[model samples]
Target: MFIDVLKNIVITIVTVLIFISAVEIMVPSNKMKKYVNFVLGLILISVILSPIVKFLSNGDKEIVNSIKSYEEIFTDNQNKFKSDNVSTLKNNGKEDTKKELFIRNFNKNCEDLLKNKFKEMTFKSELECDVDFNNITFNIKKLRIGIADSKVNKIKKVRINKEKTDNKEENEEYSEVVNYISNQLDIPKEKIEIYKLEE
Candidate 1:
């Protein structure tokens, strides 16, 4: 935790200094001041970038570590899922067939409705979906909107519209939809908005 905090502080300070130096370079200034600032900027940048260079040069150590952790989890889950699927396939063949049919139909309808809906907006850079099975609610999170960094004009937009439905079939339908959006948009799960709905 301490290391994480230190890393964040270092990144923040380096980012600020880089931005300041960039501005100093762009704006016209005295020759002496400009040269001095440029030299100092180079030194500061070297100091700031050294750790990052070392970190990256270690052959992506952190990324490999994260991948290994994910691999372990996925392997465990795959084994459990395979066993459960085998048992389910044996015990409830009819139910499994019915569920598949419903899922297919539901997905077709959703595709027809959501096609080309998100392309009209400019400020809304990305879209995400969230579903809560326990509470039977579906939610969406739109990024680059209502945030100062994104410069979105909230007043121009009326409101965010969401669809709600009730029933196990509808929940299954939403599950397919949310999963589709998550994959297609390349958005992270943490960035997705989650809400509770009837179904």
Candidate 2:
């Protein structure tokens, strides 16, 4: 019985060696070849140790159970990683939406305030702001005001030996508008710009 068992083991090993050689010849020489070789090495080791392991444990079910448990752990970890990435993306989208809403509301409020203060003139406003997401702070960088339409008439004054400039009244109006915006919005005068829109 011992001699027969030895012969069977020798035949099994020689068959496995021949199969491994055939597989190696068929596999391409590339990055994937190393991975294939590693898997085949593991199979070879397991086959060589099968008899000793069966003698000690008396069954193959324990090995299969251990492999199944490892697979379960790997799948659980992969699922957790994917969920974490999805949640991070959602949070980033929410933050971007919040910033857009804040900017839109701020511009609307400024335009409304100017409209109420200067009843005779129509104003359009644009604002540049620096936003800090970490601290949730907004810093006003610059404000641009465009005079879309004006109903105020230019006052003409008679002067002795004075050359009249066509844009003098418009310049004065721009200065006044700039000063008003600077004071009301608590922005620096230099940081505010006022321009008349072309008709």
Candidate 3:
């Protein structure tokens, strides 16, 4: 609607200017020529301004609609962005939980496998172990050297032999056990430690 009014105004101004130019060429008196030119200038300005005034009518509605559309688009995009962030956070939390569970299960399995292997050994000894987070420290916290035979009597003889234990035999036995553990578990020898149980 506004464009049609603007185009008509431009055509009118052009037509009027051409007519004035043709009249000015034919006018005889100089004073009449000046007055005619002044009237034509005023007529041209009014023609141009008339369309501008019409363009301002009902313009507030269009402006309001434009602003509202932009705001709606912005709000939609903001909501979408928030939802994407929430999903990513949820996925990250789930991934972390999965990794923690896997690590915990792996540690438990290692403990069970090592315990069963210890029980299968020839000596009747009891040992408890702990492995580090990086699997670099395998420590034997408790090691009971000998097991008592089952009997009905409650009373027992306590023998304290300070000098009778053969160091060579004990070292060989300890070395054999350590080598077997290291080989079976495929863990480094430096990471393993043996300790006697506290009475």
Top-lDDT candidate index? 2
**Can you write out model 2's per-residue Cα lDDT over 1-199, one digit (the tens) per residue?**
3455578888988899899999999999999999999999998998899877764685356556666878899999999999999999998888878777777887788789888887877877888887778897888887777787666556668666444542344446678777777788788976776666765
Give residue 60's error in model 3 in angstroms.
Answer: 1.9
Cα deviation of 29, candidate 2, in Å: 58
Ranking by lDDT: 2, 3, 1
lDDT (Cα, tens digit) per residue for candidate 3, span 48-159: 7775675578567766776787889999999999999999999878766765665566446554554565654333334455545445655654433331223233543455
Give me candidate 2's TM-score against the actual structure. Answer: 0.53
Question: Whose lDDT is higher: candidate 1's or candidate 2's?
Answer: 2
Q: Between the candidate structures 1 and 2, which one is better when assessed by TM-score?
A: 2
CA deviation > 4 Å runs, candidate 2: 1-51, 55-67, 152-173
- Alpha-carbon runs more than 4 Å astray in model 3: 1-55, 120-199
lDDT score, residue 63, model 3? 62
TM-score of 1: 0.30
Off by over 4 Å in 1: 1-14, 17-28, 93-199
Per-model TM values vs. the true structure: 0.30, 0.53, 0.42
Write model 1 residue lDDT over 84-143, tens digit each, in one string.
999888767765565555445544543443344433322212333444544765455542
Q: Which pairs of residues have clashing backbones in candidate 3?
A: none
Return whichever of 2 and 3 wins on TM-score: 2
